[model samples]
Target: MFWEPLRARFTREALTRSFVALRIRDYRRWSIAQLLSGAGAAASQIAIAWLVIELGGDGIALGAVTACMMLPTLLLGPFIGILVDRHTRRAVLLVTAVAQMLIAGVLAALTFGGALELWMLMALSLAHGVAFAADNPARQLLVMDIVGRERMTSAVSMNEVIINGARVIGPAIAGVLLVVSDAGWCFVVNVLMFVPSIFVLLSLRPVAPAGRTEPADSTAAAARPIGAWRFAMHTPAIRATLLLAVCASACYNIAVVVPLIVADVFHADGGTYGALAVAFGLGALPGAFFSATGPTMPRSAEVRAMAVAMAAAVLLSAGAPTLPLLFVGLAAVGMVVMWFIARANAFVMLSTPTAIRGRVMGIWAMALPGSTVVTGLLIGGLADLTDPRIAYGAVGLVTALVVTLSWRGLRSAR
Candidate 1:
């Protein structure tokens, strides 16, 4: 049956992840650990947003908190990349998971004691940011170490699917828990969920990075703060993917406009927001699944498909008249967004050597967060001038132009 072959192929891709990287035992262990860790991270993020709202946060406060969570990636990600190259990737990941678990515990305590303040929230956010800046590069680099390079695209896509799968499950559970008790319980659950990750990571047999390690007593490591940037700029495919990330992120203000359209126009509430999130998550899941399977299509073909989908999704969202219609548009947008991200990350992993994979991915990390920050500020100002709907429409137009102008560069990179 057609279904049998499809199922067989997917099973092969999923089960053979370690084979692709050429180290099944280590990669399997690492992948499981990452899945656990990613779920906890997603849950914790949802908890933070809800906690802020419960404490009377306005849009600006929400923005500030979100920015705090993101700013480290923008500011310190490059330096973290250097660290990823210098240190043991597995050790870096373990330390980060432990640090994040501790942060969650503190947040839980503060919430339980009714002593949580905006400053405390900001401080915890900063701590999480630092941990994330290091953890991201470490994890990306680990894909290379455990798997090598044979099935990198599969590994990258599967990793995303695992993360997004958690995204889908985490929020629904958090929502139920948030209504049943305080947000602190959400944090507690996150701490508990992270245990499996820490355990799995520890269980993996240690595999050092494939290249030369930096010397323990070197001023050289101290001097090369922006070394990741230098490395990525020198590598054509990595640079191209980073640029694509920037453009895609800038165009993603359609997400920002979703709540505005629902609340101001359709007169909806928080539940509607959750539905939109779920819709988007469900739409994106399939894209990740498809990419995880082997493909006869050129990488360029995949990227162009993503670009077209993004353009259409944006245009549809801008013109959506009702909540239901808007969700369909947002979901379509989400599907393409994942496609673009997973493909770009795959490209980065393929192009970079194991030695510098972390640094290169760190540069990729900087592009999306930095562009989102800029785009958020611009969209906020535009919302003041006109309705968010119109502002979103204009963004869609700009992104379409991005597809037109940037497609060739991306194609060349592949």
Candidate 2:
């Protein structure tokens, strides 16, 4: 009798806690679109990196390409955020999806024709980045709009789970495609994958900005672009989160650093590189799910602690003497990183007023990837000059120190 009641309670709790966002119809549709788009993007990442290497690009060249992909976010994030707040989010998403599809198609055609050049790839990366600036803020705000603050944390965590799960599957698929054919096929597949996102986006109901249910002229003052920047600057929690995000971006330049490690340190092939990527994704899956299921800790301290833990994990990966140790370190890093990102995103979403959420998220979008442009160059140059391991260690140590010193301030923000 005791065991039966206990099991019944546990089952009831599990059912209640699982995937809270899926209960909402629009969020479900949006999530499906995100999954397909995320997977396509992940696969394209592998294809793009491999293409650059095939075209005689080195570490710096690869870094330049990565930087180009992120530069537009840094440059155009504020403006795009303003637009996102002013326009219907679903419309913004539809336009971005279509733009991305067209860009991928052009890239695929060029690759197939054997006429693709490095400059052409960089130019396309810029265009892709521009599309992302609009897409990132709109999609993030749309989740908030659909689910509201009560379930925002679970919704964001679930979204991360989908994206990271796709990260695992996408590269594995790309690895297989690379074995049979070439990078162009991966781009071709990406083009087709975008179709679902376009369709789903079309079906979603239009989302109005917060406070925009009133007359447009009356709300225009509140919707001004400068207001978003001012709010983020004055808001303690948002300000600290953005700072931490930039620091995290520097430490997170593992995308560039890991490939170098696989090639130079481990002397591994493409398959091993894909396996490393999968390891990170696999670790992130549980972390995201855990966050989705229930609360962990106070968002502020939670983010700070995770940042420090992630730094330690990166150092462990940097100092790993063997492949097994390296993989273990990476998995740890992935878990902590995902938890940190989920918490930080939720914290920002919950803390901000819904009226300027788009602009706020746009700032967030800018800070996260914008830092990568600088760190990419730093990590890439360091890898080129000395060793990738040293670069990783330096970045991690610096991140840990910065977060440690700022912990009190971050805690107070809550």
Candidate 3:
């Protein structure tokens, strides 16, 4: 599901077809762990953003902290991608899980002791992002390890379901913790979330990627150092999808604006922040479920089309003057953006080989959380200068223009 991502066309039957990925036993077990970890991550993100606001920090501080969490992937993702391809994905994942737990512990400790500062938070976040870069590709390519290629389309959609579902639960939990306890408790939850996944990974055995009859080691031997980069750059469908992702990354970065909008525009509190985030996750769930029926790899044209639709969703979200309307708008954004991302990710995963997927998907990773390194600050700064509505409107227009102007390069996927 790495190469081509989807058609905007959808129907009622898609709801039933989306369950196709659940038939595999290993994938079900793997998804359970993914759901928990994703929830904890989502919860922690809101917790951190609220903590920044509480700590005498401004929008720039929010942007810097967010940027720090993503900066490592922009800087080291490609190299780390190659590294995971050369080794056992399980080991890389295990190490990353442990590293994140330790970092979360320290963060929790600092906050609980009343000694947590903005700089300390940023430092820990940068460390977390470093672990995140290593964690992402290894974990993703491991889907190939658990489920074969034929199911990759539904599996990717199911993965979105897990992520967005976590988004729904995580923020709700964070909202409660922020009201009753402290942000430190959110970090404590993060420390605990990885425990089941570590056990699951330790219990699992490895499988070879699709199209590979050889043992896993032989596959690793053929995954050359620069192969993923060269393959993605040269491949037209993959190239177009990823390029669109650069703009998609910037446009979809609404985290910075959500808090600002809730506070400044809506005059809301922590509960409202979590409610809006939940709305986003909830809205995406149906689309994520519906997307499970498509071809494993999407045509490049459809990917471009989805980008335009997502831009419209963002602009509408920006213009929502009332909170209820904002919920409707953000939910719409989440629904459309989920499809956009699902298409982009499936393109990269399905079009490429199992052997080199780790490295290639690393480059894909560079486009999102990696792109956030710049977009995070830009969004934060834009909101600081104007307002959330301006920040959202500007990025929305830019995404529409970028996707609309460059329509010719990708040859129709053969």
Q: What are the clashing pairs of model 2?
A: none
Clashes of each: 1, 0, 15
TM-scores, each model vs. reference:
0.81, 0.87, 0.88
Q: In candidate 1, where is summed lDDT lowest over 10 consecutive residues? A: 13-22
What's the lDDT for residue 392 in model 2?
84
**Order of quality (TM-score):** 3, 2, 1
Clashes of 3: 15
What Cα-based lDDT does every candidate model obtain? 0.68, 0.78, 0.79
- Residue 350 displacement in candidate 3 (angstroms): 4.2
Error of 1 at 13 (Å): 8.7
Q: lDDT tens string, model 1, 1-414?
A: 636634654675455642354247766766666666666666676677656656765444545665666678888765666567667787998899889889999999999999999878878987888888788778877776766655665567668787777766666666566656777877887888878777876776677665554477367655554575687776654565676677677554333455556556787654565566667767778767666664523376567667667777877877888778888887787778777777666667666676556556656777876556566556655754687778677777776776677666666764
Tell me the TM-score of model 3: 0.88
Ranking by lDDT: 3, 2, 1
- The regions of model 1 sitting more than 4 angstroms off are 1-26, 54-56, 211-240, 250-263, 294-298, 349-358, 384-394, 411-414
Give all candidate RMSDs, comma-separated: 4.4, 4.3, 4.5
Candidate 2 vs 3: which has more lDDT: 3
Q: For model 2, how does the per-residue alpha-carbon lDDT over 1-414 read when each residue is reduced to its tens digit?
A: 535522442355644655677899888887877787787887788778777767876667778888988998988876665577678888898899889988889888999899999999999998998888788878877888899877776676688899889888877777777767877887887888888888877777787875443465656754555798899888766787888888777765566777778778988765666677778888888767655654533468667878888889889989999989988888787788787777787778668887777567778877787778877887878888899789788878887877877776677775
Candidate 3, residue 396: how far the Cα is off, in Å: 0.5
